[model samples]
Target: MNERQFGPELTAEGASFRLWAPAARRVDVLLDKPHALRRGDDGWFSADVAGVKAGARYKFRIDDEIDVPDPASAFQPEDVSGPSEVIDHATYRWRSENWRGRPWPETVMLESHVGTFTRDGTYRAMIDRLDHLKTTGITALELMPVADFAGRRNWGYDGVLWYAPDSAYGRPDDLKALIDEAHLRGLMVFLDVVYNHFGPEGNYLGRYAPAFFTDAQTPWGSAIDYRVKQVRDFAIENALYWLRDYRFDGLRLDAVHAIAEPGETPLLGDLSRAVGKLADTTGRYIHLVLENDDNAAHLLDARQDFPRGKYRAQWNDDYHHAWHVLLTGEAHGYYRDYQHSPLRDIARALGSGFVYQGEASAHRDGRPRGEPSGELVPIAFVSFLQNHDQIGNRALGDRLETSANPRAMEAALAITLLAPMVPMLFMGEEWGSKAPFPFFCDFHGDLAEAVREGRRREFAGAYARYGDEIPDPLEVSTMQSAVLDWLSREQPPGRERLALIRKLLSIRQREIIPRLADAAFGRAHAEDGGLLMADWRLGDGTTLSLTANLSNQDMPLTAAHIKGTLIWGKELTASMAPWAVSWRIG
Candidate 1:
């Protein structure tokens, strides 16, 4: 591991505290009493607090005036406003000795938020549900951001502390135990990390070094100033800290487009190089996935000399938007461009890897967007029907089963899970849970009111158009409403939906996973009445054909030479019924 003197490091004799407060005239390490730190070169301060060890709670007094949490804190027991707790990451005994990380293609990502995944909303509570995911054929668990936010319950994207795990979901060891237990169950754990901008509240970096954030305006806030050496190193180190310290298999960088670093070597590029080196040193399969809205495919291209590229996959919002607009027939906001051609968009995304790819986008004011991604592999895109942003950001936080046409939703699930791209399932999506995953937070004072009013204003247009009632973001009931009813998975529509996903995923593993490595595989055909067919060329000379009628009316099959035993279908006839999804190995 790259040793950086920034946080509390415990030794046998005493604990050494270090912080970067270049602007401060004096810095002091405060545990029970104040111990003055000697200012070092380049604006760093250091102090060795005698008899202070792991489990010690401490804070740094900057300029002997402002008290703040450590920028590289490992655990924050009392939330972000409290002092940082020293944690010994090596104390926990891991049971994943025999486990090597799973391959990229074998990954079936289940994106979950710890706060609302269960009734308890704790890390240990999440461990009890791991067996269910394992039984459902999921290979990886992708957790949303867990860094310390301002309050008790949050979506985790509003995190300010880069190193500390949120105290609301148990301690640092509890999170480690969850990951350790997940690895023992043969599941890879991936964490969704936010490096674009810190949360609005409980952030103290600006107090110490304002250069940490740049003047560039992002959708969220000021972008990080990557041109500064310390800021760049800090971002890169945070990425490594998660992978190395927490034992997470991969990282999902949230919204890379919002990160504006206009330098020759951007923060993303430096992260790739550092992470790639860590993967080589540890001999572990570490991957980086991105949530870039711009459809930047060049990030995935690993040169012959450098194996690990910027990212392995990116969340394919184009595919989801196309599928969503087609299924619901509602195109507003960014979905406007897709209204013109939904099926064509889906076809292009399925075939060539990106729908825009330099084409003129009506949503972007007719500006040419995206780059050609035809040469990229299919797995370069991470496809999903319902993710956290798509569902939680909605007016009512309704699941696809309740919001869209039922049959269309089923057919959409079939295509999404069976597609060559890596498929991600929202928590409770497999069973079609009726619980609403609304946007909720527990902020105080003006911040809380701001969040509640902001959500109401954001969805005001949808409310006017569809008569939708936006949920109160500040209500405790809103957060409670998002919790999954685990018992519902065994009953009625949930059971049926669970069966469908299980069957499709099983078939995907047997039929699709083997052929995914082939660069020449995965082609698609779209027809009228929302009829779509995908063909995956096998190594031997046969084609794996999948047909689906996404419309509400029967559609005729046009393929003439499709002669093979039916793998999965409600009807094996000349014409497909409404919402009929079938697969054939020819």
Candidate 2:
């Protein structure tokens, strides 16, 4: 493996190519002309094409019959269907040389889809908006996946070309420039990667290597065969490629619960170890986060050595679901369990890392799920009220601000930012941008209609009343509607909401960040009249208290222990207003 490199490795004279296709009897490198490749050990093939340099277009031919793009292509200049272009990754002049990156505990991540983040939906355009993110108190920019997919616009989870940066965004150098600019501003960039399954279209890997996928079913498609050495190599190397070559600070793996590992040593566990080692060699602080619905605590276990354990955090759906149900008062589908006791779920999420720890989930057909995560640090959980899945997957893609309860939205903002755990904000969420981030895609013909029908069928069970309201995923308007109106931030409600977010972030940095080490010392307790209270002492012995009234009426704090000057509130009042939140420091 060390002797041969995958993809096109260009030198001054020519480029060398290597591919793994165990099923192919013959493989050829397709340059200006077809060049036959000599077989290597372990069903691998290699060839050195003279006069083929950087910027050259090429593909690989299998058994002199089938022609396809390089599976490890670094830049798909013509989207997914066109030939792959050779990228000279080392040529980019990076300016973030001094940037060492931030730790996970300090990560205030702002999640954004590249295509919808800016009006142009390109890397350069998004870079123009970095100043806004930096000023908003974001430490990291979590970009939705950029891997080349089948169309002009997508959420990027349908990426079939694993290595290439989508052409719709920009060229390979353009992406590197985006990361370089972000690092120069002292903001670490984290990419969201989908490894659970390949997209339904434009994937050609199964033709060359059928063993890459297993019969195990995933929500997206077939599960990856992680037990196979080559499959593991592909996944892990892709991770290191982004971290080492692209200079990303971290990665947020999407839907890792769908990743099925055949052995005790899980795919994530191995990848974590490899990334840790890479961090050591590069002398950079790289973090890994997971988006798993199962609340897999073992992934975040710090007790185990480097590779065996040590993911920085997991996206906490428990906290979001609790907040969502409480704010909206909607009890449907998976939210049914939380409707009974939303605050209790919130309290459990605050006190421990998991709300359903070792408890039977009625939503999962009474299956016992999750283990006790009370021993984990508060930063182990990433909390948010709005994210891609929470908002875009909705029937109408309405944001939290669209709900009738403004006070609850404000309260949700307060708790999300002030909590001891790491906080994430979806794009345009800070100012409550009116744009709807609906589920949108760009597959054509019969595939397009199938996607539309499948999406409606998905929500038909939970939101039957709004079945017809669900937008077609394949329509171009659906994607266009999700684009943010950046000008809205200058207006009335947008300006007001932006101010609130800025204030919350400012308070969090000034008060919460300094007391992160003491986070585990906090406690959550509820009071009468739908009041919730959480208290903790800072390093300076100053007690910071958060009181929230979830009910639709004023509630007085009757606890004898409550004695502090109100530090954060809309007005000076003895009783908390409906859905109001107050912060007190003593």
lDDT of 1 by residue, 219-338 (tens): 777888888888888888888888888889999999998888784577888898888888887778887899987888888852222325578888989998998888788888888889
Clashing pairs in 1: none
Candidate 1 lDDT? 0.83
Model 2 Cα lDDT, one tens digit per residue, 1-586:
1212467788666988888888888998888889999888877898878898779998889987788898889888877867889888878988888877876667799999999998899999989999898888888999999999999999999999888889999998888999999999989999999899999888888888888989898988888998888888888888888988889999999999888986557888789988888887777888888998888787795222233346988999988898889888888877886888888788889878888887888889999778788878788889999899888888888788788477778888888898778999999998888799998888988988888888878888777788567887888888899999899999998899898898888888887777665456378877656888777665567777777887888786555435586767754356777887777778
Model 2 scores a TM of 0.96
Error of 2 at 178 (Å): 1.1
RMSD of 1: 2.0
Candidate 2 clashing pairs, residues 3+ apart or interchain: none
